[model samples]
Target: MGTAQAATLAASLSRIVADPNDMVSLSDVLRQRQLIARMIEASQGEAPLQQVLNGAVHTAAQGCPAPMAKILEIDRTDDTLVLKSQCGMPAGAIGRTAGKAVEGNPAGEALKNAEPVIDIDVRRRPPESLPDILKDNNVVTSVSLPLINHDGPYGILEVDFPEPTQIGAFHISFLAVVAGVLADNIEKIHARAALIVERDAKAVLLREQQHRIRNNFQLIIAMVQRSVLQTTDDGCRKNLRDIERRVFAMASLYDHLLGLSVQAERADLGRYLSAMAASFDDFYALRTSGIALKIELQFGIDVDLDTCTTVGTIVNELVANSVEHAFGGSEGQITVSMTREADDLCAVTISDNGHGLPAAALESTGLRTVRLMLNGIGGRLDVQTAPERGVKWSILFSDTPPRKRGAAKP
Candidate 1:
């Protein structure tokens, strides 16, 4: 390649990763290959040659004029260039590997010499290393660039040119640059994919454990509830009801944990909130007198387990306290609104138009439990009264960064 073409290729190679599509001009590929080769020769310690090869090839075709370009990882053990990944190739041709190395075929020559090979008249099947099936179907000109890693030859890039006449020294040089980039990028992609797979596998195991834990919790709660009911003493009955309250609190937490799928990396915050609110509604309907309640929510915000459980418990305590103390002798309304703040804090406000917070709530054990839960997540709770009206609890809670779950795990 000429100095200008070489310079362009070299510059682009360094910038391959920054490009959104990871492509480069034809001239750019040539310069990159030369530069990379020098870097490989000069470097002594650990170097990322494989990644360089893949990135080079990927960038070479980024904005290419041709319809297809690809990087194939050569498994010398099998004597074939396996198509690891590519851009602009027909889906039917994906995963297909080029035929084994041959002495005279353009691709084979390039691989054998550890260099670039350009075949202008690829339309006619080359005497050697040509797949008969491809030649019969009118296969044409192709340029093959070999990818050499520190370990050995990693892959090859094959660019199918529309016309045999378009192949030239500039094209060959540019393609070489592309080859080095492909080597590097291919390695990175493979490593990243492997990490993702491992993470997904771990998440699946965690979810399965969560499922079993939830089931066992329900079973134990059932047995406890039954045992409590079998007793007739009023004192014992009261104690069981308190036990049932705590168990239900935990049960609600288990319900959310179990609802997560084996593949999920994080809980669905919106769903958990909706379900928790619904549970509050049901609990009131079943336990209280004629007090009717209403709930409204704005969703799509996510939170971690610690924060979610604390929030749920706080809501349980507040709603139950409202229904128990505020309604006096008639019906009332309860409104819940929660939103995520820009600073990653969750803001919650619950309001009811019954008797305001009892003078004793600030000193009550249940209130203390609620306070402790809020404090655990770096949140604060406050009770307010609307002139001669009911009670409202304004709360602020902080949560851990949202984690991915199942298919959502990136």
Candidate 2:
């Protein structure tokens, strides 16, 4: 052949080789775009950790024909890599652990150097140098990338082929991108888990503090009762007893708040009202013997701490008055009921089957205190009393309203 003919032949061969290289470059670009799109979709998913791992492995395996794709996270406790998620690997190999030695393992080497490592032929390596899991699975070629970010090395991504396969620079580049996405997702999941732990700790602490406060209030009640017994004057003794009852009423509110399953700024009115009634029954039995007192309580709404306390105080005064004067030291029954009136309004009624109130209403100190408490909490009081029959007191209140008094019952 002449010199001109040989030169022409060389140029044609050069073009032939360049065409496949061009095609391979185009294929890599498309694979990179696909991996990026999958990452974005995975990030938007509800389960961040699962989505990230699955996306990383699926994307890597799709780009390269690998029989198995796995993600191994660094277990900082023991300084080893543990398999976290995998595709096409036996279930037993899911949690397999490997030491941090870079001598024979491609994953360890990649993580140690914060780079990508590819082994085209693993069968040639010494049996001792191969990981038992990989060898058992008959893996012939593998590519590993370190999941490193600004926070440093986190884990490793590995794709294993069952048969001898060649991995190019473009394939390694795709795996590197997948590793970066997985690293970011892992950090976010860890941060969220830490936040949940901190929140639970705070809740436990708050419950303990509330328990202590209730105990302290109980001590105060005991001291007041002691003072009541020590006083010689009838008036002074009665006043001390009243004070004790009011303190007990407040303590009941705290107990009801603590019993709730969920922590909130408000207390349940129904539970608070029921507890207060039970406490009053016990107190009545202890103070006055041989007198039967039956209390019927019904609740239908909930209120906040401040509102519950005010309402409880009012109920305490009303019940005490009925026990002291309504039955005139005889057997009687009292019914305490609460119901929701509107979207934000509620009504509570306390009634007794005994002699009714006197013609003049709001005559005693206890009644006056009830009226004041109701006013303070933006509530209204209504009294229905009949001579020689019975008395019923209904209180209407709103969740959010201006403090005011309603018309007196005639």
Candidate 3:
């Protein structure tokens, strides 16, 4: 503004302040406009969208001389202007949705023409018309301004007063500028949040891919070790080979989990357990020798991903041990069953009908792995072994104790 214009605005403000009863002078109006322009510049840099919208609603209603005001956003689903934030309306009338267009309502007219509608009585209009709550709140006249965005009409901003004659041109101008600022802020916030979500999802996928590569590397190590030991005549070397293979198989299963995406605090127990047991088959050529391993699953909803990995690792270790020691230098059958028990617990049992576990094997490293997995899932392990008969190892996990789901028990 020029110096002359600034001087004129100051003079007008002085006149209005001196005579409160008289209509505001041009200079007073210009001063209000200048203040609004300053506020706009101050708000330009950065602010949260919700904060801007709510602040604008409060500013237009309380900071201005106007009696009441609101920022309305269109609900695209319903094609109606719904109040997003408001001040000065009765609490019950704060969030009412304006009726559909038929004729004569200020909001409907503004919406239809994508322009401002000033000095209109909104009580009588189309289908269901104005809500009774608004009428009860003593709103006699309203001005509605459509909030336009890149996609076209977003919503409307409505200001209310006890009578139409009480509203001034300055008040309406200031509200229009405020509405634009609010719309821009909303768009910025929405775009930023969407970008964050997209980035996080991609990061998760990449991590899973890395895990699968690690598992493949472990499998290669186990295969090489098995190949070297199989050509040896020493019984001690064969035993060492079996131990190495089992450890490598365990590590491979952990790697396989990277490729698996378990949704929100829940894991696919069936797939996880199946994947772990299947890893052993990949390491040992048990299938070619007719020693078939079968899996039976009956996991319940409360069994999350953490529980699955723990239980899966335990099952893998037990089955591998059985194949190594119990088969009597020949092929044998292995059965794995999981079923939910009474009292919010899940039980997994691995059984084989071959040479049973001796007392000395109870404290073995393989059994320790089974016990650790069971404890991690808030459960315990019970081993039933009879010499020359068979062995049954059962794991029981309960929901009462909240334990980390995927970590193996110590």
Q: Model 3: per-residue lDDT, tens digit, 1-410?
A: 32322322232222222225547568766765665565555556566665666666766665355678777666767666677777787676546776543245566666666666665555544425664535766666777766665566566677787765445555555665555555555666666779878877976776776666666657667675866657666766766665565556456455555655533455556555666667656666778655788789764434565665566666766777788788867778888888777767677889988789889888877667667656666678888889877899888776443653333354
Number of backbone-clashing residue pairs for each candidate, in the order shown: 42, 0, 5
Which candidate's lDDT is highest?
A: 2
Q: Which residue pairs clash within candidate 2?
A: none
lDDT of 3: 0.64
* Top-down TM-score ranking: 2, 1, 3
Predict model 1's lDDT versus the native.
Answer: 0.62
lDDT values for all models: 0.62, 0.73, 0.64
The Cα error of candidate 1 at residue 261, in Å, is: 8.3
Ranking by lDDT: 2, 3, 1
**Residue 219's lDDT in candidate 3:** 67
Top model number, TM-score: 2
Candidate 3 runs further than 4 Å off: 1-188, 191-198, 201-205, 208-212, 215-265, 279-282, 299-306, 399-410
- Using alpha carbons, what is the TM-score of model 1? 0.61
**Which model, 1 or 3, shows the larger lDDT?**
3
Tens-place lDDT digits, model 1, residues 253-359: 77877766555445555567677777765655734666655666657666777667767767766776777677776777887777777566667778888867657
Per-residue CA lDDT of model 2 for 1-410, tens digit only, reads 32322322232122222224534667668867876786767676445687678777878787775779998877877767888888888777778875453667777776776656678887787777677778877888987777754456667789999988977655665565566556666666777889889988998898898899899889999998888888899999888888877888878887887887546756668778887777775776724634444544445465666788888888887777788788887677777888777887788888888889997766766677677777767777889999878899998887653333343332
